[model samples]
Each structure stands twice: as C-alpha cells, then as structure tokens.
Target chain A: MEAKNSAKERMVQSALELFHQRGIRGASVDEILKRSRAGKGQFSHYFKNKDGLVLAVVDYLEAIIRSGQVDSNYSFSSWDDFEGWFGRYIGFQKEVDCELSCPLGTIGNDLTNDQDHLRRAVKSFFDWSTAQLARFFAERKAAGELVESADPDALADLCMVVMEGGMLMSKITRSTALFERAADQVLSYIRSLR
Target chain B: MEAKNSAKERMVQSALELFHQRGIRGASVDEILKRSRAGKGQFSHYFKNKDGLVLAVVDYLEAIIRSGQVDSNYSFSSWDDFEGWFGRYIGFQKEVDCELSCPLGTIGNDLTNDQDHLRRAVKSFFDWSTAQLARFFAERKAAGELVESADPDALADLCMVVMEGGMLMSKITRSTALFERAADQVLSYIRSLR
Candidate 1:
C-alpha cells in the first residue's frame, strides 16, 4: 500500500511539473512516466490516461491551495493582511522570474471545450478557491472589519478575476507592471469598501 | 495569385477554428488540411509549419481586432460609450453561449513556455490591442471626455486585464455572472475617471 501511494504521488508530481512547463498536450504520458521513474503499468493503474492524470493534477493543486502552501502565514484579518498576501504573491512571481503561471489558470486555459471532465475539475478548483476567500471576507464583515455594503462573494470573484487576468498579462508581457496595476485597482476597491 | 490567396485564407480560417475548438496541440495538421480542403502541400507552401500557421492565426486575429469586426459601432467617446461597448460584448457572449473564449487569450495560454516565436506573436497581438485602446482613451482625454488624471495607457491595461480575466472566469464557470462583475467594476472605474 505504501509503495502504491508513493508511486501515485510521484506520477502526479511529475505530471504537474511537466504540464506547467510544456502545457497539457506538450507533456506526454511516456515522458511523465519516465520522469516519475514509475513503471508504465503504474501510470495506467493510477490514471486512466493523460486526461485522467490532468484531473489528478487539478486535485493535487487544489489540495496545495487548500493547505495554504501558496501563502501559509497570511490571514484575511485586516486590510494589512490582504496587502501582505498580495505583496508576497507578486514577490514570488519576481522570485521565479515571472515564468510561473498559475497552475490552475494554465491547466484551465489549455483544455479544449470538449474536455468537459477536465473543465469541470478546473471549475471546481476555481469555485472552491473563490468560495474560501468569500468565507474569509464574510467573517471579516461579520466582525466589522469590512464595510456593510461590501458583498463578500462579489468582491472575492473580482479579486480572482483580476488576479488571473493580471497573471496572464504578466506572463505575456514578461513584466509585473500589468499585475501591479491590477493589484492596485483591486486593493483600492477593497479599501473603498473599508 | 487569387487562387493561392484563397487557399492560404482557407487554411488560416480552418486553423483558427480548430485551434479554438480543440486547443493548439489538440488540433492536428492533417485535420487542418482536411478541414481546409487544401492539398497537404499547400500548408508547407503557405506556412513553414504548424508554428508558422499559428503565427498567421495570431495575425488574422489581430486583423479582426484592428478592423473592428468584433464590435465596430461603439466608439469609446464617453462613459456611456464604454458601457455600450461592454453591453454589446456581453450580449455577444450570451449570443455565443459564453463559449467564445478570446481567440488571442486561448491561443496564448495554450503555448508552451519555450515557444518563443508563438509567445512573441501572442504578445504582439496583446500589445497592439492594448495600444489601440490606449489611443482611444487618449482621444477621450484630449476631447475632455475623460479626466486629466486618467492615464490612457494604464486605463487601457486595466480594461484588458479585466476583460481577458473575465472571459476566463466566465468560460470556467459556464456562466456570465463573473463577467458581469468584472464589467461592472471596470465601468465604475472608467466612470470615476470622468
């Protein structure tokens, strides 16, 4: 059982890295298996195919987001908290030389319209992340940290849109200027609500 | 010459359609040839290869934007103009059932990180689009329709970010709600500038 789980983990990890670097179709099943050092049978045993592996990658990414691996220390307790979180995120983008695309965004964009299963997985991940942020804002509102007029759900959705958009533009431009503009605008909107 | 141009056009049209439907890597060269009804040799005759074909598609999309084929009537002359343009855009989204991802955005996202030629092509499309909008905003500011504090370039960047971001979210959720939120915020920001 232990060996099985580790092999599965290895495949998922390898798939995630290759997919990020080469995109979904660019990364092949054979390459993933070779990189993971897992036998060919292990891949078939763990995943139905490349598409199935992609779904697993989505779930893995969701787990990472949920576990706070992206930004473990930040809490949405105050305005400062939000700024700190965004600052770190932008800083991390710089740390990686702006080559890092959002794992979810990259996967989501690479999927074809016929890829209903993968699309749903990506959608669920975004919905889950958005809902988590919404809940945080709702809590802040309940505690009077946010203004009465601020709709937590709407705000959360806006933040996600801007962040994703910003990331896409940043990746294309190879500069963080677009993202900073987006972050500034979102921060101002949040501040206005306060 | 006419026959050659038409054949080239057919291939570009077919490639654009297939790439949008199946993604870049998902669309095969043989499929593009079959759909275009062009001789297999025509592809090499017109384009160096699939990557060259993708560059042509980028140029085609850029031409569409430049020609104002997407939304030609509404000029960004005032706040109401912005709203009208966005309204038509959202209406088009509904007309297409929200499956119409930004052609440039979709292709740009699917490219591998190492695809410098394709990446540069996508970046040029974005820069051209942003510059066109920036010129519009500059006109508005010159005509006193927008506030003096408004920077046309920055405003244009924000609009593009929100728009591409909104399209992505809308595509994922399979709902127009996220797009509406993004459009609303962007409109509000533009309005505030006036």
Candidate 2:
C-alpha cells in the first residue's frame, strides 16, 4: 500500500512538471508514466486514466498555493508585500525567458469544452488565489485603510485578470514589455484607491 | 487562376472555423480539407503545409479585427465607446457560454515555444489591438479629457490584459461571474481617470 501511494505521488509530480513545460495536451500519458518511472499497471491501479491524473495535479497545485509558497506569500497584508508579489511576476517572466505562462492558466487555456472537469479543476486554483487577495482587501477596508466603497471582490478579480493577461502577452511576445507596462499601471491604479 | 483562389479561400475559412471550434491541434488537416470540400491538390497548391495554413488563419483573424467587425467596433474614440466595447465582452462570454476564449489568445496559449512564428502572428493581433486603444487614450489626453499624468500605452495594455484575463476566467469557470466583476471594476477604474 505504501509503495502504491508513492507511485501515485510520483506520477502526479511528473505530470505537473510535464504539463507545465509541454502544455496539458502536449504531454501524452505514456510519457507521463515513463517520467514517473511507474508501469502501466501502476498507473491504471492509481489514476484510472489521464483525466483523473489531471484532477490530482490540479489539487497538488492548490496545496502549493495554500502553503503560501509563491504569490500567495504576500497575503496582501501590507502594501510592501503587494509590490513585492507583483514585482516577482516581472522577475518570473524574465527567469522563464517568457516561454511559460501561469501553470493554472496554461492548463485552462489548453483545455476544451469537452474537458469540463479539467477546466473546473483549473478554476479552483484561480478561485483560491483570488480569495487570498480578496481577504487582504476586505481586511484593509475593515481597518479603513481602503475606501468604504472599494469592492474587494472586484479588485481581487482585476488583479487576477491583469496578471493573467500580462502573462499571456509575455508568453506570446517572448518579452516582458507588455507585462512590465501592465504591472506599472495596475500597481499605480491600485495605489490610488488607498 | 480564379478557381484556384476560390479553393484557397475556402480552405482558409474552413481552417478558421475548425480551429475555433476544435482548437488548433484538435483540428486535423484532413478534417479541414473535408470540411472545405477541397481536394488534397488544392491544399498543397495554396498553403503547402499545416503551419502555412495556421499563419493564414492568424492573418484572417487579424483582418476580422481590422474590419472593425467585432470588438474593434468601438475604436475607443470616446469613453462611451470604451464602455460599450468592454460591455460587449461581457455579452460575448454569455453568448459563447464562456467556453471559448479570445480567438487570438486561444491560439497564442495553444502554441509551444518552438512555434514562435505562429506566436508572432498572434502577437501582431495583440499589437494592433493595443495600438487602437492607445490611440484612444492619446486622443483623450490631447483633448484634455484625461489627466496629463495618464500614460496612454500603459492604459491600453491594461485594457487588453483585463479583457484577455477575464475571458480566460470565464472559460475556466464556465460562467461570466469573474468577467462581469472584472469588467465592472476596470470600467470604474478608467472612469475615475477622466
């Protein structure tokens, strides 16, 4: 039983990496199994199929966010953290050479309507991410740091849109020009609300 | 010669429809040919290969935008046109049932790094879209309708990001909730600038 769980964990991790690098559809099931070092029997016994594995991959991603490891690190507790978080995106595009996009977004965009279950899995990550940002705004408003009329949900959603959209542009252009400009404007706009 | 041109147009139009409905990779060459009712001779006689067809499709999509047949309808000459343009996105997500994303972005996201040429074709559309919006913002600043502090390029890119980002979320959640909130917030933010 322990070995079985280990194989499943390995498969999920491998899928996550491959999906990020090659896109969700670009990675085949056999390649995933090979990378996991797991046999066909083990995969069938564990995931049942590729869709099941994709769902697990998404769940793992959510765990990463919940752990407050990356963007969620800011928690929007302070303006400094907000700037730090947004700045990281600029650094991130350069680090990745503007080749990759948001893991969640890349998956979401790769999926089709027939892949509804997979799309929903991606949405869960977006929802969780937005909630973290919204909590910060709500807290700020409660403390009068933000204006009374400031819409936390809308603000949070805007932040997500800006980041996702900017990331998409960066990936397409192979340059962070659009993302850099977008980040500057969005940061200033958000600052004005305070 | 005219007959050959007719066949070429049919192939491109069919490719556009198929790519939009089934995704870039999902639509095979044979399927596109079958849908076009054109023979294999016509395929090679025109595009030469699938990548060629993809480039043509990207150009076709750009033409659609330039014709102001869709979102470019607003041209963003005035604030009312800006609001109308953004509003159309909300309506669009509903019309497509949040299943399809920005045609330009969908192609960009689906492409891998090796497909840089295709990515650039998609980028041209983005560049054009940004220029149209930037022109609007620039006009506003010149007319003293907007603050002197406003950066026209940044504002235009922000608009692109919001729309692209909102379309992505709508596609993921299979609902327009995130998009509606984002559009409302972004619209209000821009309004405050004037």
Candidate 3:
C-alpha cells in the first residue's frame, strides 16, 4: 500500500520537474515513467493520460508557488522588503539554473493551440493570482502605502506580466540578470506608487 | 519554377503557423510537409532538418514583426500619436484571435531545450529589439517628451515584458481585454511621461 502511494507521488513530482524543464509535449510518457521509476501500469493506474498527468503537475506547481510561507518575520514592511522579495524570487531561479519555467506560463504557452482543460487550469491561476495581488495592492493603498489613484487590478496584473516576461527572457538568455533588472524596476514602480 | 518557389514559401509559412500553434518539438516534419503540400524531397531541399526549418521560420516571423515598422514621430510631437501607435500595436493582436504568440516570447519559450543555432537566433532578436526600444525611449526623453527620471533601458525592457505577459494572458483567457488593458496602462505611463 505504501509503495502504491509513493508511485503516485513520484509521478506528480517527476511530471512537475519534467514538464517545467522539457515542456509538456517535449517530455514523453516513457521519460516520466522511467524517471519516476514507475512502470506503465502504475502510470495508467494513476493518470488517465498525458493530459491528466499535466493537470496534476500544474496543481503541484501552483501549490508550491502559493505556499508563500516565508518566515513570519519576513514580511513586506517597506519598498526594500518588496524589492527584496522580487530579488529573492529571481535569485532562486538562478540558484536552480532556471531548469524550471513558471509552470503556469510554460503550460500556458504550449496550450495556445488547443483550448482544453489544461488551458483552463492556466487561466484560473492567472486570474486568481491577479486578484490576490490586487487585494494586496488595495490593502496597501488603503493603508496609505500605494497611491489611491493607482488601479490595484491594473498594477497587479502588470506586475504579473513583468515577472512572466522577465522569466521568458531570462530563460531564453539563460541569464538570471535579466530577471533581476526587471524585478528591480518593478520594485521601483511599487516604491514610486505615490 | 514559380510553382516550386510558391511551394517552398507555403512550407515556411505553414511551419511557422504550426510551430507557434503547436511547438518546436511538438510539431513533426510530416505535419509541416503535409500542410505545405510538399513532398519529403522538396522539404529536404529547403531545410537540412527541423533546426534549419526553424531558423528560416524565425527569420520570416521576425521580418513580419519588424515590418510593422517603428514610427518616426516622436513622443514630443504628439503624445496622442504615440498612444495611438501603442494602441494599434496591442489592438492588432485581438483581431488575429490570439493565434500568434509574440515571436520572441514564443521562440524563447521553445528554445529552452534547443541547444544549437535555433537558440542563438532567438537570443539575437531579443537583444536587438531591446536595444532599439531603449534608443527610442532615450530619444524621447532627450526631447523632453518623457520624464527625465524614467530609465529608457528599464522602460523598454518593461514594455517587452508587458507585451509578452499580455499575450500570454490573452491567449489563456481567450480574451483580448487583458492585452487592451495592459497596453492602455503603458500608454497612460507614456502620456504621463510627457
């Protein structure tokens, strides 16, 4: 029984890594099975198909991103903290050698051809992400941190774009610096919000 | 001879379509050849392999984007025109049904695994693009049209991100609204610079 659970967990973890690094279509079922050390029978038992595996991977990736469980003391008290957050985010990518694309953005790019269930998963994440940031901005603005004239939704949405775009460029150039510079600018904008 | 040239052109065009619609690795030679109505011999004559085809397609797509052409009109002369040009740029995508990803962004996303010439081609376009935009922003700032404090390099870089990010979101939601909103905010920032 324990081995069966491990098989499913291994498949999800392997799919997350492979899909981010190799891409949805680039990573084949054999690679997943081989990497997970699970046979085809095990894979079939867990996932209906590649799409099913992809959906599970997306969920796995999203949970990691949203956990945001940095030390309670590690809070955004000032623009410096905000900027530092962006820096650390970029720093983490560099530390890993950028083998992972934002799971949502990577899948989002590949799913352009077919508007299947996979596409919905990507959209929901962006939508929820946009809203969450907007809420943060709204709170900050009410607290007199952000300029009231600033549209929380617009600013939050734009910040998301900058991060993704920076990610796209960083991945292409294999230079984590591209992300750091852009994130710095985003931090500046957030600071200049008055 | 005309038929032969046309067939090659079709193959390149179709391959670009499929590459963006599907992906670099996701797309197969058979799919491209079939779409182009060309035989294996004809394809081999034009391209050594998939990489050769990608290089040609990258050049083709880049030409189309560049041909949209930069406006000589400065931000100082007419902020409205600047805004309009930016709007038209974002608006054009909506009319196309979110079928095309930004060439640089799309290629960047796919190039993660392509280690040879294809990756270099994509990186070159992005570097050149960022430089050109930075020059434009600097020129505008010199003319007193843009805020002196605004970093041309950073702003140009942000524009790249904003556009790429907007494209990603637009494709995911199957809606043009996000692109339009993001573009509007940029235009607003540009106008504010004036």
User: How do these models rank on lDDT, best leading?
Assistant: 2, 1, 3
The CAPRI classification for model 2 reads as: medium
Misplaced by over 4 Å in model 2 are A1-5, A71-74, B1-5
Candidate-wise lDDT, in order:
0.78, 0.82, 0.72
Cα lDDT tens digits for candidate 2, B157-177: 888888888888888788888
Model 1 steric clash pairs: none
| TM-score of the second chain of model 1 compared to its true counterpart | 0.88
Give the runs in model 3 whose Cα sits over 4 Å from its true position. Answer: A1-5, A69-81, A98-100, A112-115, B1-5, B69-81
> How good is the docking of model 2, as DockQ?
0.68
Measured against the true chain A, the candidates' chain A TM-scores are: 0.89, 0.90, 0.86
Q: Model 3 shows how many backbone clashes? A: 0
lDDT of 3 by residue, B1-194 (tens): 56755877998889887887777876899999998899999888978887888889988776766665433222323445545644554565676676666655675687655464677788787777677677877878888777777888887777767767777677777776767766666666655666
The DockQ-derived docking category for candidate 1 is medium
Q: Can you list the residue pairs that collide in candidate 3?
A: none
Q: After superposition, how far is residue B87 of candidate 2 from its true place, in Å?
A: 1.5
- Per-residue lDDT of candidate 1, residues B35-142 (tens digit): 989887889898988899999998888787667776733245555666676566567678778775667777887776677788888888788767767888898899
Cα error, residue B157 of model 1, in Å, equals 1.7
Off by over 4 Å in 1: A1-5, A72-75, A143-148, B1-5, B72-75, B142-149
